[model samples]
Target: MARIGVIGTGYVGLVTAVGMATLGHEVVGMDKDEGKIRKLKGGEPPFYEEGLEDYLKRAMEEGRLRFTLSTEEAVKGARYVFIAVNTPMDDDGSADLSQLLSASRSIARALDGFSILIVRSTAPVGSLDAMVEVMREEGKERGRDYELAYNPEFLREGTGIYDFLNPSRIVVGADTPEVAEEVMSLYEGINSPKLTTSIKNAQIIKYASNAFLAARVSFINEIAAVCEALGGDVWDVAEGIGLDPRIGRHYLRPGPGYSGPCLPKDLMALIRMSEEYGHFPHFLEAIHLRNEAQKRRVVWKVKEALGGVFTGKTVGVLGLTFKPNTDDVRNSISIPILRRMSKQGARVKAYDPMGGENAKAIFGDAVEVYNDPYEALDGVDAVLILTAWEEFAKLDWDRIRERVRRPYIVDSVGIFRRGAPEGWRAWTVGKGDLPSPEVSPESDV
Candidate 1:
């Protein structure tokens, strides 16, 4: 197996480090945070991701995984050093490459010779080329050229481990095809097809992939709004369109628009990159606008259900995370919707299965965060579901109907059924109206 060094112990870094080690590679994950390194060395994952801790522990037990704060120690004698640092966008929308450049400079300082430095961070198109320039500049000063490559990660936080092990394709980009071949050899155990390209194409591929998915989500969400207006079911519409062999279905669920670390940021970065090159990515721009509009659509739905105003309305929101089974709330669509509701004089009560703590940091005292989903509905005027956690699908809506002051529901994620309750008013995306339920005395309370 390849001897690997992973820099920057964030989600991607941690997963990549541990996963490579689990695949029998000798891995040393380096970070400047001593506390994080200490925690990881003791078998504690710095964040919550399903199965990451288990795999980390297994790798640690197998003596293949190691953590260090010193880059010198981590990269010494390692044949492959994977740079997995964050490349968050700046105020100008251009990628703030400071973190990446810092990590590259540090890796450069520690390089001995003939080691492949792989950039695995999601970066703007041409970013890999810029990074190669930095590496060659540093190498020139040190009188040695370090081999460089790029392997963009397509990992989703909640299902990161599964995605890594069963990736759809493995991409490796480099200065030359031979460098990509060397990089591909590192994943000998992986059965996925490999795509090799130049540095510029590799960087663009990552952004293009995310931007296309964002477009798909926004396109469907926009259609869902149209369907709602026309009394048509968007689910049926999307499924019908998705069945086309050319369009194959995935990411067509119309809900609170796509929000996570990747899509929004990558789209903005791509836009910024396009502006730099004197071109306008009109479709990507439209996608971004549509996503923001989707968030506002939730607010409009709330206002409609609450009689055209949120003044004095008690609104209960279910699901706070950007999506299901993930605690990450960066740019989560729920945050903006909550802020807008609260600003309009609505009392917001929210319950998320796992994102409460992160939500608390964002909302502060503006909204009441309930530990129990049912408790969040206490005396609320209407309930809105944002994230599509499976628990929401099976909720005792009969009990929730009894607790709320107003029998109104807005099912943005399709959590409520039609013909469920008398006096029950609900709006669902991509689906028909929620049915009123058969009322029973015991079930009502």
Candidate 2:
């Protein structure tokens, strides 16, 4: 079994450490966060991901996994050191490599012998060069002291562990074919297509892949807007086009545009990276602008539904996370949408199965986050479904209708495919029917 050190125990690093341990490797995960390291040592995950706790427990029980606060202890004598630190988007739309470069410097000082340092973070194309420079300042030379490789991770947030264990494909880029092969050996038992290429290509593949997915999301949102105007069902349109072997159905479902830790940041980074290379990516820029517009469009739909006024309205929001099955609210679309509504004098109440606490922290005082979905929906002017969580679909619409002041819903994710409850006026994206005010119960007399 190979000894592996995974630096930065955030979502990617934690999942990688556990996944490597599960593969029978002796893995040590290191992070600077004392609290996070303490939690991991106690077998408590800092964040939620499906099946992560079980897998982490199993790996720890087998004595193949451990956590540490010392970078030197983690990387010393390891065969492979994976740098999975966060490369957050900077104000200038480029990747801020501060954390990554800091990790590399630490790893350089801690290395005992020749090891393969694999970068698992999503960064710009030339990020490896910056890492090499930093390591060189610490008196570590590449090819002699350690080998560098790019192995970008493509794990989704909610399904990160599963994605890591059962990846569709593995791409490893190194300076030499031999070095690439050695890095690929880390996943020996996994039966997936492994591609060995240059570092530049690997980085591009990572950026292009996310950019393409973001583009697909923006394209579908634009189509959804068109459908709303032309009275065409985008759901049907997406399916019909998706069936064409060239286009897949994934990322075609329209909602409040793509907003997550990776997609938006990566898309913006790519746009900036491309611009730095003297080529303006009009298509990518448009995709980004369209995503922003889609978020605004959701607010507009809510405003129009409320007779063009948000004053004194209590908007109940269902789903606050960027997606379901994860607690990550880093760049959720719900934040901006709700903030706009709250600023317009609307009282915002929201609920999510997992993201409530995080949303509460972000929206503090502006949004009332409830543990119970029903409580959030109680006595509201309108209900907006944002994240498309499965539980939202099975809600007691009858009870909701009774509690809500007006039976109006702006279903951005189209959770009510069967149509809203009787007497409810629902405005669904990409649907022809526009929501009309529900007639008061006394009007029936």
Compute each candidate's TM-score over C-alphas: 0.92, 0.97
Model 2 lDDT per residue over 1-445, tens place = 9999999999999999999999999999999999999999999899998999999999999899999999988999898999999999999989999999999999999999988999999979888999999999999999999999999898999899999999989999998999999999989999888999999999999999999999999999999989888878888899998998889788899999999799999999999999999989999999999999999999988887676788888999999999988999888999899999999999999999999998888888999999999999999988999999999988898899899887889899988755877778788888875544434422221
Can you tell me which runs of candidate 2 are displaced by over 4 Å? 434-445
Best by TM-score: 2
Residue 418 Cα positional deviation in candidate 2, in Å, after optimal superposition = 2.5
Clashes of 2: 0
Query: Mind sharing the TM-score for model 1?
Result: 0.92
How high is the CA lDDT of each candidate model? 0.84, 0.91
lDDT of 1 by residue, 18-128 (tens): 878877899999999888899998999877899999999999998999999999888888989999999987998678888998898788788876678888988777665
- After best superposition, candidate 2 residue 1: deviation in angstroms? 1.6
